[model samples]
Target: MENQKKVFIIYHSGYGHTKVQAEAVLSGANSVDGVDAELIDAKEAAGNLDRIDQADAIIFGSPTYMGTISAEFKSFMDASSSKWMEQSWKNKIAGGFTNSSSQSGDKTGTLQALSVFAAQHGMIWVGLDLPPGNNSSQGSEENLNRMGASLGAMAQSLADQGPEITPPDADQKTAHYYGARVAQAALRWAA
Candidate 1:
């Protein structure tokens, strides 16, 4: 495993829903052979910036709050200014995911912010390759990528529900697929 590629998932979960999505992403990344994946909470990301710098891929996640990423996740982004100045993440593969209480919670805004952040660091942005699911007459809520997000994985949960019951299976699957895609891209990029 000495040559294994590392994938880091950095995220902030407001009500545990985003954390569930992050775990799904981790599971997907780890499913790839020779890939080692880990999750770092945004709250603790500042202390682990060096570890993230060494990763071949980095996936960001957060709960979409007020049409954007949570303030906590934004803080992590701000803390990485030093790395940005050094261009330490240049050429790294990057992806993003977000969750919110509404179906169309402007999750794209959060993903866009993440992609822009990666671009600022000179990292390559890996977007969801899945075609829009649940967009056809035959589509259903069980379809993956139901949110139809191409920028990144998107998940929606009910405000009244907890992470254990919300975000649904399809959204979880979409997050998983996106993670694997990023990991696979990282491997290819490194090669």
Candidate 2:
């Protein structure tokens, strides 16, 4: 019970594609030996701010639309006004993931926006430290952006047609990396 990692993932998926990536994150986090990762849909999260408050780290995910977090995720952030006022999310580790339609889709933009939001909330940010793009053999899909495009869990799903075309690999890797990174950060923070 002591020193177990506590991780929470809050996400919003419009067409259930992003949900695939979100679930992948949960899988990776749960695979970690000492981590407890939970997935909270934005709709469900709105009613249970405690879920966010109780974690050592929080990971946010969404389907990037118009180059940022979805309207649903924005609504969730807005609803967190109460927590923001109370500083409920402060001092915790934070991370993010997204799914869109292109290789350079608005997914990363969404992650950046979320990162800024976490900082504004007085939280620490954990980005993927894995080396993705440097290795030529790893290529695009095997690199962090290849097989694991998610050190921060930002993925792109093409079905939504945002330009992050054919992002299933990106989504899987993104989810995996985000989950592991969150768990790793939470464990350290909890220590």
| Candidate-wise lDDT, in order | 0.93, 0.77
TM-score of each: 0.98, 0.86
Per-residue accuracy of model 1 over 72-108 as CA lDDT, tens digit each: 9999999999999999999999999999999898889
Give the range where candidate 2 is weakest over 10 consecutive residues by summed lDDT. 158-167
Q: Candidate 2, 152: how far from true, in Å?
A: 2.1
Poorly placed runs, candidate 2 (over 4 Å): 134-140, 147-151, 160-167
Cα shift from native, residue 169, model 2 (Å): 3.8
What C-alpha lDDT, on a 0 to 100 scale, does residue 72 get in candidate 2? 89
Model 1 stretches with alpha carbons more than 4 Å out: none
Q: Give the true-structure RMSD of model 2.
A: 3.3
Q: What's model 1's lDDT at 7?
A: 96
**Alpha-carbon error at 16 in model 1, in Å?**
0.2
lDDT of 2 by residue, 1-191 (tens): 66777888899987777878888889888888888888899988988887778888888888888999899899888888889899988999998887777766756778888988898888999887765653476365545555244436656565645333345665576568668877887887878
